[model samples]
Target: MSPAITETMIYDALRKVIDPELRHDIVELGFIQEIDIVDDYVHLEIQLTTPNCPYAENIVAQIKRAVEGVDGVHRVEVERACMKGS
Candidate 1:
């Protein structure tokens, strides 16, 4: 059987997703709000620096791609939330 999926594995994968404007990985930027994993599905809640960030869509896409590339990940769901008072 394949290795079980874990939060560490997912986080490691997400570390590769970089913020285009900040030029730093999202994980390092602390944009990841939450991560929920069930079976092969991964749900992520990300907090952006701004509510109207131009790269929001791109960031979401990159997040999904990054998580999807992880072994044993069959599906990915990403939710975005703007930082409070930002």
Candidate 2:
């Protein structure tokens, strides 16, 4: 298999995505679970602290924008998943 995307870069990009309600980057809040990059497309699985997270959509959009802003990224796909104990 090819080398996986660097987790540091992924986390850095995610730092640009902030949660409106929390007024903080999701990365700092431990929201991002995984990131996969393939053929210049970024796939992200994000975990929200709550199932009814008020800023879920906004956070996803922000994450998409942040990832897409990366130099080699052609597309960004972000999926929101609820945290188990949330």
Candidate 3:
């Protein structure tokens, strides 16, 4: 049996996803807004610098790939997090 997927593992996987313009891992930039394990799927919320950030699609893709590559992650869902009070 595979080890259960924990939030730490998810965070570790996300470290591999880098922001091209910032040249930093998305985790370090605090882009991971939320993480929830519902049954076999992992739901993730990513906070972007802005609602209209041009790299939204690409960054999301990268995050998907990174999180899904983790051993016990059966699925991944990504969405943008709204800015505080906005």
Candidate 4:
């Protein structure tokens, strides 16, 4: 059986996701707005620097792959958000 997934594991995995343009990890850039785990399901929010972010898909895909790589992750629900700077 796969080992149980933990919040630390999720965050650590996300730390490896780098933003192509910024050349920094999404976590480091404060892109990860929220993270929650319900049973084996993982629901997270990734806030972008802009609504029409060109790298949105790539970032989401990276997050999905990372989260799914965890042993006990049954599913991942990624909600995208935009935070436009003033």
Best by TM-score: 1
Collision pairs in model 2:
none
Clashes in each model (backbone N, CA, C under 3 Å)? 0, 0, 0, 0
C-alpha lDDT of residue 23 in model 2: 81
lDDT of 2 at 81: 72
Q: What CA RMSD would you report for each candidate? A: 1.3, 3.3, 1.1, 1.8
- lDDT string, candidate 2, 1-86, tens digits: 43445667778888987788788888898898888878778888888878888877877888888877776777788887766865
For candidate 2, the lDDT comes to 0.79
Candidate 1 — worst ten consecutive residues by lDDT sum?
A: 77-86
Per-residue lDDT tens digits for candidate 3, residues 1-86, read 66888899899999998888888999999999899986668999889878888888999999889888888777899989898878
Report lDDT (Cα) of residue 62, candidate 2: 81
Q: Which model scores highest in lDDT?
A: 1
Candidate 3's C-alpha runs over 4 A off are none
Sum up the clashes in candidate 1.
Answer: 0
Score every model by TM-score.
0.93, 0.83, 0.92, 0.89
lDDT of 1 by residue, 1-86 (tens): 55789999999998999899999999999999999999899999999888889999999999999999989999999988767875
Model 4 lDDT, full chain set: 0.89
Ranking by lDDT: 1, 4, 3, 2
Off by over 4 Å in 1: none
Local distance difference test, each candidate = 0.91, 0.79, 0.88, 0.89
